[model samples]
Target: MGIEQKAGNMGVVTLKLEEVINWSRTNAMWPMLFGLACCAIEMMSAQASNFDMSRFGMELMRPSPRQSDLMIVAGRVSRKMGPVLRWLYDQMPEPKWVIAMGDCASCGGVFNNYAIVQGVDEVVPVDVYVAGCPPRPEALIHGIVTLYEKVKEEKMKDWA
Candidate 1:
């Protein structure tokens, strides 16, 4: 792995910078555990023995935000929780991505009260919105896959 070289000009595969970065990022997405409500159960199910999310490189659901770049907001974010969410989002290092899992997090679901924030997007910028009261493990996986597609197309020029 010292240097990438063509095998006797058999065929050289070319990959865009974005593709390479996105591939690495998606393959090793370490999503932090930021579940706030019922969706937490479904989030847990995605990581349980049945789903085995390890194959997608999300087996370690870290509790500390400082150690993670991917955050799965898997529940309703109340008004009181908004500040906490922002604080944690700030704590995370750069190149961070957020997934608003479930309707509650994406749009406050059936909650139309003042206590609810209406959406986690008000608290943090969302990279993906997983629709449902609590999206099934497959749904979450699909959401992640969608994110991966986005990541793969991200332009490095934006960072510069």
Candidate 2:
């Protein structure tokens, strides 16, 4: 009843440029569509109509790293595959993020062998991790939301 009443319903609002930019980034993040193992299927399910990740502004799963801002490492990273994963991560634009999905990707799951990379964090920095052998689509969605919240609180100094 204070500012709104004085404005007479006029479309007027105030926000810091940092807030505006962060909001935009959170709403339009394009995830990379690079799948490595079984968890890849679960990742795809999040994009389907049932889970419907598009509503969160992640409808497009970019196959090209150049077009992506988020990298969802949905499966385990083998020792042999570590280099490839890092290469792909390096290809994504700045202000990028990563989600380690599934137990295998997070900590090697049952594969405690040298061939397994132990955790994808060894290959690329993970921003959020969704736990489970192959996490349900809902879990993946939650991780994305968590990332969004983190992005929203980012400072201008951090972007540089």
Candidate 3:
């Protein structure tokens, strides 16, 4: 007998399977159009026909945060931009995700001098931290896929 049969329920197993499928489908994200520095150019390159981020279902770069589910903090986070970043993050709907796309965004890079926010995480919750002085397009794509996997594994109802 299968695990479902041993548990005395075929219907419950079917429902669970459906839930998993739906979660995976919905979590295929669309990232917002926001990039601050050198990393922004790399991000653009990733979306271009060359690298093609569309394969992962994340090519739709929404102009508005409300329409996007993922925010890729691609460069340095200055103190002045910190509030703006937080506001943008807040604007995004529930089940949203954030990616710190480079050393600058992840930990302020070489700019430990004044005026920088130190790390994008200080302003918004980061789901994935992609390390590199400026990570390559491949690394960015890998981070997006990693985020998708995390979203798929999330227990929706339990998440508050």
Candidate 4:
């Protein structure tokens, strides 16, 4: 017999399972432990209490890019460090997301010197840009949520 005939309702069961899997995947965003400047401090603060980034399931900050799914560029990108950043970004696994977590990472901030890369977008494709000299914890949280929304909106076939 067909699935519809064998079961009173197979659709609900399939949907429930898919919902569970997607919920688990979206909630767990393991960010790589990389901080280049002052904004790094803000990133850490977001993970700490008060702001409590753990509430959104991003508390586990992985030290290795191989294990991380999210890369939070939390500072200025100097010419000397640009190559290193690119190398690290390339190391991250598939389905990865990049969060430019400050004006420095997003647009070079006040450091207009020739040594700066102007913006990290020049090195990597950013998924979200969190603006601020040093973006507040709330802003970082919002960026993560936005990334989650994007992940949800993406078509499954696109990943294939």
Candidate 5:
């Protein structure tokens, strides 16, 4: 429900679990570190002092998939790595989100042969697609902010 005015100074408001969960999720997103190629550098820069991803509540990039809820696929995925990607995604807990963090991760980018998987979505679902050969650190922040907006609107019925 939208914000409402309290009848008195007692201070009480009504909201659903999904809305509360979404609020917590957006503010405390922990992205799994799963970079695969050149775009990985840009992804790393996002965590550095200059960009400071901690401001967005993501200071520590989790190396283990089980401990994180957000996944930033930061490069071109290869056909050989498809199963690994899927396995990691499977390992993450429910209500997780995925960000395809570059043209390479979103699509095949420059590589268009049998080696490249064409897109990370081909292996696992993508929630936000950050567009660029290797999108700048600022762009990554934008993507995170965009995901936060999306999370803020989610409902319990929307999940499986």
Candidate 6:
């Protein structure tokens, strides 16, 4: 009743279900096609041929919130837009993650005023914060890798 006896020569590889699930989730994260301000350009650059986000398995951004598992909030969030942002976050399926890209999105950047929300976290929970006026594409990639690591370490109980 051992694995060796069960698969004498057929090359059967075995792994924990949790590990497989985590691996799949990390590799094929589809981000929502949403942006608000300047940091969005940097986000697009990350998707360009030079940076090529495809290598990480995200070939394109999904336009529908329902189809996206990741949301990159690239730029400042206006007070008026807070409810809209929350609505979109709520529309997304369960087990979704958010990245506040750039200083503007993370903490309202230089536009610290009543019109600005001060931080995207005020509207939605952010899992990672990429700090910069508009973070470089490399920095965005680094943030993504960091997020991947976080996702991979998730346990089934946490999901529950």
Best by lDDT: 2
Per-model TM-score, in order, reads 0.89, 0.91, 0.85, 0.87, 0.89, 0.92
Q: Please, what are the lDDT tens digits per residue for candidate 3 over residues 73-148?
A: 9999888899999999999997688999999899888999899988888899999999987899999989888887
Off by over 4 Å in 1: 1-14
Per-residue C-alpha lDDT of model 4 across residues 39-103, encoded as one tens digit per residue: 99999999888899988888899999999999999999999999999999999998789999999
Q: Indicate the residue-level lDDT of 29 in model 6.
A: 96
Model 6, 1-160: lDDT tens per residue? 6866886765766998889999999899999989888989988999998999888878879999999999999888898888999999999998899999999888888998889989899889999999988999999999999999999899988777
Which clashing pairs does model 2 show? none
- Between candidates 4 and 5, name the one with more favorable lDDT: 5
Residue 100, model 4: lDDT of 94
Clashing pairs in 3: none
lDDT of 5 by residue, 62-121 (tens): 999999999999998888888999999999998799999998889888888889989899
TM-score of 1: 0.89
The true-versus-predicted C-alpha distance at residue 124 of model 6, in Å, is 0.7
RMSD, each candidate, Å? 3.2, 4.5, 6.7, 5.8, 4.9, 4.7
- RMSD in Å for candidate 2, one decimal? 4.5
Candidates' C-alpha lDDT: 0.88, 0.92, 0.87, 0.89, 0.90, 0.91
Clashing pairs in 6: none
**Candidates 5 and 6: which is better by lDDT?**
6
Model 5 lDDT at residue 123:
88
Candidate 3: stretches off by over 4 Å = 1-27
Write one digit per residue (lDDT tens) for candidate 1, span 64-154. 9988979999888888889999999999988999999999899989998999999889889999999988899889989988998888788
Model 3 residue 75 lDDT? Answer: 93
Pairs of colliding residues, candidate 5? none
